[model samples]
Target: MELKQVIEILNGNVLTPSANLGRQVKGGVGADLMSDVLSSTQPEAVLLTGLCNPQVVRTAVMADITAIVLVRGKHPPAETLQLAESEGVPIISTRYGMFEACGRLFQAGLPCLERPVNGE
Candidate 1:
């Protein structure tokens, strides 16, 4: 789905003014643990989390994530927003909780990453 669609679906507010809303996101991953996100998320996925920290932006950069949705109406710190801007990661804020946000995106046709059948 497109980032613009995500913003509309989640009723999100764009915190990064420079972020492009036209970017396409292939999938969605909801996690507060940066390690879990790093291990599981695919490239160009949108990360949904309530963890509003600079590390989230760093993790998004490392994972090649396209966008970030901060659930539960949480907003990142200025430093975190600055880091996200520097990394070209768009940060979005939503009033929905993590579960609700994920559900909304899923209903909107964004799938979660699938684990390999071999458990690799």
Candidate 2:
């Protein structure tokens, strides 16, 4: 799934790194706990979360996640946007909840790639 498709699926709007909306997403992961994301998120996965904090971007960086979809219409703080901007993780906002966002991506054929322990 392309980042543009995620925006279309969740009716999201790109708030930062607008140019990244066309990036390709190879998988998806839904998690609110930053620790869980760090443990489980895969490269190329579009992270779906309601956690509106800079740590979210930090985790996205560690996991190499390409895009972040803020679910339930939640938006991250400016600091988070700055972090994402610096790290090149595009941020999008959507009214859909976490489960709904994940389902939408899955229904759209975004495969759930297995998360290896090392995520190599």
Candidate 3:
């Protein structure tokens, strides 16, 4: 799914104007914990989280996340927005909560690919 399609599916608004809305979403991951996001090996995945902050943007950028979906219609602070724009990370806000937004994305064929633990 493309980022544009995700916007329509989740009824979200793009907070970062410079973001590449046409980028393909290879997978999805819902986690408020940045540690969990960092642990995932999936590349170019969209992150769905309820926590709206600069750290979220930073972690997404570091994790190479394709985009961010802020649940419950939450928007981040100006610092977060600025960082996201500069980092070229797209941040989207949706009216649906984290669980529902993630489910909708999954239903739309975006899978959450978590890395195996301890070579399991």
Candidate 4:
């Protein structure tokens, strides 16, 4: 699925104006824990998390994740937004909870792409 489709499907708003809506989203990973995300995330997958923090963006960078979807209408602090912008990571906010957001993307043909911590 394309990043733009994710925004439309979830009724999301782009928090980062610099975000490229044309970026390809190969899969999805929903998690509140940054550690969990670092452990299981796949490159180019969209991250769905309710946690509104700068660390989320940092995690996305480290994991090579495509974009971020802030579920449950959560908004991060100013630093989070600034860091995301500096890092060139797109941040999107949606009123839908994590589960529903994931469902919408899954229904749209975006599979859940997660890796085992053990690299299995």
Residue-level lDDT of model 1, residues 10-100, one tens digit each, is 9999999999999999999998989888877878999999999899999999999999999989988899999999889999999999999
Candidate 1: stretches off by over 4 Å: 114-120
* Model 1 TM-score, all chains together: 0.95
Candidate 2 local lDDT, 48-80, one digit each (tens): 889889988888888888888899898778898
TM-score of 4: 0.95
Provide C-alpha RMSD values for all models, in order. Answer: 1.4, 2.6, 1.2, 1.3
Worst 10 residues of 3 by lDDT: 110-119
| Local accuracy of candidate 3 as per-residue lDDT tens digits, 19-113 | 78899988888888899899864889999999888999889888999999999989899999998989899999999998899899889888876
Candidate 2 local distance difference test against the native: 0.85
Candidate 2 global Cα RMSD: 2.6
After the best TM-score superposition of candidate 2, give how far the Cα of residue 18 lies from its true spot, in angstroms. 4.0
True lDDT of residue 10, candidate 4: 96
C-alpha TM-score for every candidate: 0.95, 0.90, 0.94, 0.95
The lDDT for every candidate, in the order shown, is: 0.92, 0.85, 0.89, 0.93
Give the clash count for each candidate: 0, 0, 0, 0
| Winner on TM-score (1 vs 2) | 1
lDDT digits (tens) for residues 1-120 of candidate 4: 789999999999999999999999999999999989888888999999998888999999999989999999998899999999999999999999988999999998999888866656
